[model samples]
Target: MNIRKRYLVLILFVAIALGAVGTYVGLAFFADGTSPSGNLASSDRDLLTELADQQETIEENMGKLSKVVDAFSIIQENYVEEVEDKQLIEGAIQGMLQSLDDPYSVYMDQETMEQFNEQIESSFEGIGAEVSMTEGNVTIVAPIKDSPAEKAGLKPNDQILSVDGESVEGLDLYEAVNKIRGEKGSQVVLEIRRPGVDDLLEVELTRDAIPLETVYVDTREENGKLIGIIELTSFSENTASDFENGLADLEEQGIDGLVIDVRGNPGGLLPSVQEILSNFVPEDTPYLQIEDPSGKKTRYFSDISSAKEYPIVTLINEGSASASEILAASLNEALDYDIVGETSFGKGTVQQTVSMGDGSTIKITRMRWLTPEGNSVHEVGVEPTIEQKMPEYYYTNPVQVEEPLTFNESDDKIENVQIMLEGLGYDPGRTDGYFNKETQAAVEAFQQDQELNVTGEVDEKTAEVLQTTIIEKIRNNEDDYQLEKAIDTLTE
Candidate 1:
């Protein structure tokens, strides 16, 4: 009985010991329904494997990404410091523009871009001149005639020292313009130093509506012949229309010769220049052409029908550029018209404005203009036919004419000056030289032709003679004036 009890006790003790060990193992590593030493229940292993797979997928997708930006955005949203979104956007835009290598390609905000466009369109008000920054200071390029900037005693080659008491240091042309331009009637104080002037002159210009002088015309006899002088200031939107009207006016006044002045004219529109060239060139004559990157060529032609057939002379200067060069080149090539004055500003590249999805636009140089002879005038200026230097008198007071006898303000007498100049054997170059240098030269030649004094100066007797001969030509509808004068002189 004692031996049997001892065996049962030992069996109960071993069962208790095994149960205790299993419970301890379960609590230590498999309490959440798994096994110790890498052994696990099937359901538990499947659930854990799914979780592991999901975690691995998430890490694979996002581990490569730098979350610094996202973190920064989050911080910015909840940041204590107030930051303007527009400022940051503008800064980003500036940074982007700075990346572009072109200095002209700049990022102008809505306000600045709008202001720039308006300023270009009006091209008036403000200082009544064109300005650009050079050498870190504002520089005056050209002053328009009768403008406040011109009348208020501002001149070209003047270095602007300061604007409104602010030193224009480290500023670009755009920045200088922003400081100089203001509302009409507002004053913009500009300290300028002219070439001849020693001390810096403080020019307090009372900003006014600068009247844009597109075309200026004058009719007076030169060297005894009635001639008309026209100076085109700029090639604006309405410049072509204005030029047409000027031509008509000169024609009505019996304009014998035409002098086209294009001095200090920074070119504007392309179509306007084409329209201007049409007045002299015959129809279908190529006015200008441009070649694109894809080997495509676009050509513009003359369309005007009532252009006069007379000696035409064109005057140009260093400021003449773009459309001016186009017009001058077309006339000189097509008509062999005489060109007087200095070389033109060489800028033949055409810019095409393309707008981005954002309200910004990019004016890119799309093509370069080619002359009729396939010559590039991008850096090389057009060579003049006559290459006449502008006389001091012409540069000073271009409208003054020597002829006392004015032409009849009628179409019949419109060609009178041409006949008179041609009668004098002056060859003002083209009969189109309404009152330009060619006509003046012809008048001087007429004085010389008549065996009188040849001073290139017109006297009253010379004017009377030229006027009478031209009137006779108009009445008789004679094409040759100089021939008749020679015959009459020989008879006399």
Candidate 2:
């Protein structure tokens, strides 16, 4: 069962007898950072005060609350643009949260609150991607598997510079998400700037219905032995059950090795991940370390054990985050499971959501996440045992092609150019996995169609345009070198 959500609602006040006013303050955010050890010498602290002195303090706080109420009333009555009382109250709450300067601590208005709940319910529609403020830049955490985002070639760690031609350079994560999402069948254009890339890449994509499919699995044979691949899109409600079912299915297939791919999986519910890990990890042992406000470290243990001794390998990349990092770190730290691919997204902070009535909520960062081995995965993500960098055009490193691919060029990069050209409706006649005359002709046609110089070659400008156009509709093909490497690692 889910934990009951807590709230910090403001109680209504009444003008009391003899003009006395009342106000109360909760101490959840107030902290002095005092040590929690028993050696502290503040046992003789004053515990009692005069009634008049207490009354004075209460009145002082009351005056502050009164000013807020007065401001709310003024805004509701005198603002040129009509504003509702509810809007004013929500605005006040939003203003307070903004003052904290913590990107994770946010005020969810009624609409945002409803969307947030629906998302947790694991049913919603849009590009189907998770985003966050990474180092003050609005970055893609991960794109859900088989969703419009994945179809659009949106990769993790891609910083969104603009949405639909509007600059979102300093926009908050929620605002950026709102700008990116739209009605089904609508189109959105994203100007993205990725790490280790020299230029900007603009991806034009269509919004589609995001189905509630999180865990994806398939089995294949390599060297006459079966290898099971479990691809986790996100840590949603359906993940654990789907994962268990996947394991059962793979077991029936007589798999020799297991490869858990969290390449682009953004994390989900903590409890959900904990439940999933319980199957493979040992019980009564620390699988994760969480540090509270006072710097006290608490270890979270697994609940159950697996009957089968399965060798597991986890595949991660820059997009693997939160719950993804947890699964990777726990398996490696305790079970010694090797992680392949690139480093994961370093989001180590834990957010706690408190609901305010009328469908409003506030999510605040409460604690820091650490691995069971006492390693911090926040900002400095979990480094893979085998770091595998992807191709430059794989969206991880979107560098321009310095050399041009002309006729008779039989290089590997030319093969990709041929594939991309074929994907963009310019048939290259025969895709012999080389840049033949047909490939050069197709490049010329594409350049002519885009009003370029029609150079019949793939230069820096042509490569950038080709990569951007490739995001229109991505194929879940063998182009994922990192994934192929993980599969190969497990099979070998």
Candidate 3:
């Protein structure tokens, strides 16, 4: 549900509270003050009249509630099909709230309400992932690493066709997620279809507790100069402390340059972002500003009290959003840092989750954030300072364009091999129209690691398993391709 619905709900709650209070006070006034034994003046009579008016107002409001209850009773009794589940009613209310056309506004049911609260604490179970519905299909937005979904091989952009034999056609995103997720050790059957596949592939995966870890770090040497690479997946609850430790590790390693990879991150905690930015930015520097619908603006400043001097390069892509954008825009505009890669996923608004009495919570867009330079990045994404294309060889091969090879060994298998190789540092050439030697080498390496026959040939069984793995990785958005690209660019 949107901001409008949230405020509307709030208003309704307040009105109901006031009505109850007024009814109580009015009854007391009539019983105690307007007694026949009491000598009442004109002013007392006026006060009694005012109390009577409040009583009438309370009765009118109760009458409206009665009418609604009566209408609901009529529908429930006379409707063609029997409405058995109370959950359906809750879902309908949630759906109606969402129909207000606001992405942030939502009504959460009992299960989802608990999930939302847990999300704030930055931990949960059953397939760690963020999912969204696009074009009538449930697409994996991002999967938490080492989570059930990630371990089970979910990927970004993988369309969920069915969950446990139930067709998920009209089911919204949350509904689809609830269907896939369950208690640990429980198996969820998923029917998924890739981009260019004939039959729907069924993957039965056991659900597990998915812990949320936000900070990821590694050390790399760029032309004899060691560089510390910190890939912050998202700014969840413990992310600020996590990032601080990562920076301390870098300091211990004595790296000269730093690379912060924010690619494919959908963003998380706001203060966590500010905390991380303070590490690179100077003290009290204007970071990013926010403006609410009421035109009230709040400016957040960097608080890097004391830190080492190092050249920083923040890498971003189309998937970088919210808090990531805040940091990037702050550094890019205020500190004049170089940002690399494609345009960012422009989402400037801030959302605050509001809890309902029923245990469910609603996340509504409360405010819009702006860059330090006062740029509004709402649908218009942030463009990088240095525009770099994933080298032609990185994106695809020129030769494969004209003459594409037909794979008797499924296209899925070849692509899988290609991705593995790309991660291992040998360019798989192009992900384009063919399976070539580059792809074969990737296959060999993966096979060798698996202790399978090092034949490098994609047979039927290999193809099937390969499809499953690739589809899962893609579903998780944990592609080695993105990491490889970031590392390559840093080295270059």
How many clashes does each candidate structure show, in the order listed? 26, 0, 11
Where is the poorest 10-residue window by lDDT in model 1?
391-400
Q: Candidate 1 vs candidate 2: which has greater lDDT?
A: 2
Those runs of model 3 whose alpha carbons end farther than 4 Å from true positions after fitting are: 1-12, 15-92, 151-153, 193-204, 303-308, 386-458, 465-492
lDDT per residue (tens digit) for residues 53-110 in model 2: 5556655666566667666666756889998766666677778877887778897767
RMSD of 1: 26.7
Per-model CA lDDT versus the true structure: 0.59, 0.73, 0.65
Please identify which of the two predictions, 1 or 2, would achieve the higher TM-score against the true structure. Answer: 2
Candidate 3's residue-wise lDDT over 186-224, tens digit each? 888888764445556666678887666778888877678
Best of the candidates, lDDT: 2
The C-alpha stretches of model 2 lying farther than 4 A from their native spots are 1-88, 169-171, 196-199, 305-308, 396-474
What TM-score goes with each of the models? 0.56, 0.73, 0.69
By TM-score, the better pick of 2 and 3 is: 2
Choose 1 or 3, whichever is better by TM-score.
3
